[model samples]
Target: MKFLYILGLIVLLSFVIIYYQFNPEVYSFFPECPFHKYLHLDCPGCGSQRAIHALLHLNLQKAMGYNLLLVFSLPILALQLFCKIYSYFTKKTLLLHFWYSPNTPKIIFVIVMIFWIARNLPYPPFNYLAA
Candidate 1:
């Protein structure tokens, strides 16, 4: 399991590095969101691919235009990675935990719903959340 995990990580990292090195536009691969084309609504992850592409290229403004959620996500991911490395070297463990009292699936559903609604809202700040 550990070997497979490490191999998978290597493969994923290689792809990410290559993709950023190339900087191909996501629209070239997926011209339009199938869900958006058919349903007329943006999914929770609508602009994630484009956002990542922009972020990897160090295009912060373009990345934010692609997905505001990424602004928070990238920092959180960096912080988590920093903590994980710090803990590993300090003989401390970082275990996963949830602050909510609700059941896991329910909490996930709620989060998705909130994201969906927030992105679709027509108000100024919230409207910017949409792709």
Candidate 2:
């Protein structure tokens, strides 16, 4: 199981490295988001690919410009992933108690929905939120 996890990480890292070398925004092979294609509106995940590409290249400002939500959420997500992996390897949980609450999922969902809407707004300031 540990080996599989490590292998997955390696594969993912390799992909990121490749993506960093080749900008996804210029790659014709990268899939366009169907939600945005049909609706002509930016989705919550619309710029995530470009953001990851920028991040892997150590361009923080470009990453944030592509997807601020993804840029901001990455550290928290990495910490959560690290905690899970640590628990699996050590059989001892780390900071699990601090993350869980009855309303956490609901709150996260609401925030995502709000971001989705805000990014799709056709006005100033909010319009800049779109990719």
Candidate 3:
């Protein structure tokens, strides 16, 4: 199991390097958004691949242009990643003050749903939110 976990980590790290080195827009190997491809609508995660590539290169503006919500959420994701890594290495979990409320997931779900609908709206500001 540990060996498998290490292998997965290596694969994940290799992909991070690949994302940093290559632009997803110029790369055909990257996966397409099935939701967008089929429905012609931008999903919550539409530009995530391109955004990840831009973020890996430290191009915050480009990353945000690709996915505004994703850019805003990176710090939270990074914090979770930090906690997971620390716990994995130290065999002790950090007592974070997040997600203690039962309503957290429900709140997040509502937020994502709102973002999805708002970004798909065909108006000036909302159109800007589209990937």
Q: What lDDT does model 1 reach?
A: 0.73
Model 3 stretches with alpha carbons more than 4 Å out: 1-5
The TM-score measured for candidate 2 stands at: 0.89
**Candidates 2 and 3 compared by TM-score, better number:** 2
Model 3 root mean square deviation, Cα atoms: 1.8
- CA error at residue 93 for candidate 1, angstroms: 3.2
| Residue-level lDDT for 79 in candidate 2 | 92
lDDT score for residue 111 of model 3? 88
lDDT (Cα atoms) of all candidates against the true structure: 0.73, 0.88, 0.88
User: Among these predicted structures, which one has the highest TM-score?
Assistant: 2
What does the lDDT come to for candidate 2?
0.88
Candidate 3 per-residue C-alpha lDDT over 1-131 given as tens digits, one digit per residue, 9 for 90 to 100: 67876897899899999998889899799989999999999999999899999899889998988898899988987787778778878999775566567888898899899999989999988898899
Give a tens-digit lDDT track for model 2, residues 80-116. 9999888888999687564698788898889899999
Per-candidate TM-score against the hidden true structure: 0.68, 0.89, 0.88
Cα-based lDDT at residue 116, candidate 2: 97
